[model samples]
Target: MSKISAYILFLSLFLLAACDSAKKEFETLKEGEILLDINTEEYSLNGTVLGKTATDISVIDDVIDKPLYKELCDTRGKFLEEALGNGESIDIFELAKLHVDDNLSYVDFYKALSSMYFCGYSDFNIAIGTNYKDVFQLSIPRTDYMWCGLVIQRMKGLRYKYLRNRQKLSLSEMSEIDVEDRECVEEYKGLDLLLSFYRKDDGIAYVVSLNETFFNKGSRFDGYNFYTFNNDADLWKFIEDIRSKVDRQIGNMPGKKEDKVLRLLANAHGPNKVMLVFQKDVLMKDIAPIVKKLNTYGYRFAFDLD
Candidate 1:
């Protein structure tokens, strides 16, 4: 055979082998689960990883090596010590608010953390320890709505804090309760608040729900159009103002109407965009008219998922 012919034959054989290997890998994946091709230039989801396929289930080495979990754990530990103190009697929810005000990044704190947990990069168990519920409340904060509950419960082992509404808490009275009790009472009042952090042998996850009432108290509107520019401050201010508006509107609405409205607004924004987080199951149908009113007032708007 000619030298060129031999070279061609070798190349064909190599291609055939590669094709066989790829096919075998593709066949091993399951439905619902996606296979990420981290080895290639494109991180394509070649096939399902969970439900059914032939791709072998193997952890991505690079994903396993992400230091985000460690960084988050360290940050949380420091935050806990500094904010709550070692044996200091302080409010957990308030501390969370303080952290949000002081250290949280505006671009993607919640979404990035959620992704890290979902991707198996962090150990949620170690990150949370005994404070899982409190962490969850602080992470998400809207538990009163039904839809928000669906999102929260889908993550792992998480429950919304429940607070019965009969107590009629004043603002100062509510603020003074211990973090855990405050979250519990808030939940019972048809307000869902959660803070979740979980870890297992493979990875870690952190989720928080912000108290809409508390968040709104700190938020303001600077009169920027929501449809244009997407100014960070303006966006945050609008959200804050919306929270206040929702609370007032809830007073007039009947039959769990308030929780529903809060949920819809919470679901509309991505983690970074969400200055306030709520429970997963709350209904949010009534807030549309209010949002329209804001739009009429010249607050431009856009929705983003982070």
Candidate 2:
């Protein structure tokens, strides 16, 4: 084939591929359904979906309930006893202190629990609490009692500040728009750790803003990112990959720092409708483990090239 003919053929293929990519199907879920229901018997514990649509997913078990807490406490105490040896002076308070002092990453903390069977493969539950006293809260318990509460407290305050600042920006932008002859009041909706809503004078609903910690570095409280969509099935599939890798690494001992970082980035950006920009070369391999792990969680993994 002539050079021009070959070039035309390649271009046609590329355009067809692009058109195919643009077409995506969305699935809706009703409330109280298990967004990522994993049958422990059929699936590996390491594999679990991270995201669930509010309408479709059901609650498998509330790991935060009192009974679960008690079980965890008893198991953790036993592990500590063995680690410290028989009759070595140790208390829960002291153990908590050590966890805080070390500033251990999630990987290290998970390893500590798994080593003693105090904890097993589990997805880190990320909850957004109601606004109270003008503060937003995001709470995820520490597998280790000593530092988990403190860490959560600090994270809640930081998340509040980040969301509040972003809201201010959104409101300011709305105000600058011309509304000389139109209604000018801003209707504020409830706020949460993950999302805030607002209605403008023009009757357009706006998503106030998501927490900034997911994208910003040097924000001491930076950990994971939360993405929202009209549909959550695809997002959850991606999340399962991350959860699987995290669980597998912790089980193996000596979890890698890179894994944690990549998981954070993917969790924060993967579900967004917009394109994500990052230091690709630096985060490339770090992201691979997460993608590989997602398969165990039962998600058909695919990249959003668009």
CA lDDT of each candidate? 0.32, 0.30
TM-score of 2: 0.21
Off by over 4 Å in 2: 1-64, 86-306
Output the number of the lDDT-best candidate: 1
Q: Model 1 TM-score?
A: 0.21
lDDT of 2 at 170: 33
How many residue pairs of model 1 clash at the backbone?
A: 72
lDDT of 2 by residue, 68-139 (tens): 234445544565667577655443322220010112122222222232223331222211111111111111
